[model samples]
Target: MKKRVWRSGLMANQGFNFQKEHPGIALCGLDCYACPRYHTIGSSRCPGCAGKYFSEKHPSCGFISCAFKHGRLESCGLCPEIDTCNRITRLKTVIKDQPGYPSYQNRIANLIKIKGTGFEAFADTCIHKEALLKTLIDKYNDGRKKAFYCRAVQLLPLPDLENLLDENAKKGYKSVDDAALAVSNSLKELANKLGIEVC
Candidate 1:
């Protein structure tokens, strides 16, 4: 039996559609685009799960390798066997109650959204959140607030998140430190009002 190649290599050899289908979402439904590492520059930057250079960055990501085994599927959520999959069970156990980066908590929600709205729509939603997250990173990252910022954008509604970002932009700041603190506080207040706990 011939070995089956997947992702970028397969895209080059076979015009694989999975790589292009919804680029930033992982097979297990993590929002790669919202991750701080995805926003980092230089060699440390992650290209998102199953994203370009992903094979180089995370060649052993179990879910991606699993998708390769499962007929080149784009997302595990699309798999018929998702409900019974031990991998997802493991994932839920692993991501539970981590102190920071609550964005990872969105994994199951992202999968459910993918199941409900399809990949294209889910991609659009991720893209919108990515743009918002980039703005937060570019303007308000105090070198310590990236995780909170990521969680805020992931957990908050787009219009509300965007509104807070815009509101923060118009405020005067004595320094970037002040600006970063204000942005964190603003998002925190919004998070509190929504009962979402972005911290």
Candidate 2:
């Protein structure tokens, strides 16, 4: 069988501009842009969970299939059963143990926020968060910290993240090393408070 490729306009180098298209938000509330796969180049690229591309790649994706069966809603948040769905609970349990996966709890939270605030507002929030995350990635990320940083951004409130970014900027750091050192403990503390793993 030919390999299936999900084609979302959001894939890097796939002619989709995330900042312009806002294609990073998935129906399950996964921030496709924040996933390392989304940033990957070449054949490993993913257009995100909401991408126009669908294939046998995820034959067991209950979220996708369920959404399709239920009026083709853009997100599970639209479903009245969202809070009580067994599939979502099962998926969350599976995702929680996966290292480097965006926080499942966070995904649900994003879904609720999206449902309450509307896609346009949610997309704007995502874009702003991405910008902040980019700043951290540019200034503090080493080869090993990418996943940790992504998780941190996902778990931290936007205001807290913005404050951290501002704090770093105010410190006049001279190098990535310096910036990382300055924020490492604080990041760890915040992660711990949220009961999230940073490593």
Candidate 3:
């Protein structure tokens, strides 16, 4: 049998339609756009789980193959076997030790949020949040703060994030480094209040 190759896009133009097509949601409910890898520019960029680039890279990934091809589900949350799926359980175990990756608990929470809000609404929210996160990164990120900022954005509510952005904007810092320092300090405090560590 010939190999079944799923090619979505090629290099350079890959993931161009990522926002419109996938809105960053993975089959397993991870927000691909919010991930650090997805934000990276150039050849190392990830097109997200719904992007063609992801299919090209992880064509046979268990979540993609099982949910889309076999289970015929959009997200694992829609599957009756989601709770009992060995794959999910195994993945959860694997990600636990991986720093900077979303914990299994975070994935489950995102799934529940998506199930409650519907795909379009969830995608819209993700897009909006991603924009806010990008602003935070662009304005406030030092070279070492990307992961910390991403984690802070993921943990905080949209309104809070927006408020922080607005507040930070009004501070009139002297330099990009100054803005980054202040934002980083404020985000660290906010993260502490939310019971999340931004390190």
Candidate 4:
């Protein structure tokens, strides 16, 4: 049997499993499953945002939608007008909570501006997830004392607002408890292990 080279858009390492030990947590608003990066990595499951996609069956992402539709942003990072971007602005809160988020977002922003797609850099990061995880863990621990280590935040499948409403008896409410929180905890722990300062 010939090996299947996973190719959604770009090239990637065959047999790479993105969801190895990850717990369910929606790290970003984007659907990782539809992301060309995840597709190329052989992940049938969306890294995060599966629940939302499952509900619409179209994988409607607030970030992607806003970028392509509302903001007219080819890419979130490429948006010439960042002030008009609610999606990126919303993410700012989440990014601010984590030590490593600003840098990551800036890096992605830079990549999006310079490189057409952010997936190439993401794919490279995924290629070294383990090493990166370890490094981040160390940095987290080290940063704790000084309070400035950027820990890797875990991304998981995000349930759509409809799904959340449905599960919540259609009250149209969602909370941190609605989705899995362990993934974030794990990511935080990993950062701590790496000696990254985190609170």
List candidate 3 segments past 4 Å from native.
1-20, 70-73, 92-100, 103-105
Say which candidate scores most in TM-score. Answer: 1
Per-residue lDDT of candidate 1, residues 1-199 (tens digit): 2345545466443322235355567788877777778778899998776777666665356676567668777788888788889998888898786556655677887788878888778888778988988888888887898877877777888889878878878888888889999888888888888888766
- Model 3 pairs whose backbones collide: none
Candidate 2 C-alpha lDDT tens digits along 17-91: 112234477778778767766655566677666464434223335566566566656677778888799977876
Candidates in order have lDDT scores of 0.76, 0.67, 0.70, 0.35
lDDT tens readout by residue for model 3, 1-199:
1332334223213333222256377777777767787788788888777565565555445565566544345566667686789977876786667665553347777776667767677777778888988997787877777777777777777887888889988888988888888998888888788887667
- Residue-level error in angstroms, candidate 4, position 76: 2.0
Error of 4 at 139 (Å): 25
**TM-score-best of 3 and 4:** 3
- Which clashing pairs does model 1 show? none
lDDT of 2: 0.67
For model 1, what is the error of residue 157's alpha carbon versus the real structure, in angstroms, after optimal superposition? 1.4
TM-score of every prediction relative to native:
0.79, 0.67, 0.76, 0.30
Q: Residue 180 error for model 1, in Å?
A: 1.4
Per residue, candidate 4 scores C-alpha lDDT tens digits across 57-137 of: 333445443333423333344455555556556666766666533334343343343345453444434334433333333
Task: Candidate 2: count the clashes.
Answer: 1
Off by over 4 Å in 4: 1-60, 70-75, 94-119, 130-194, 197-199
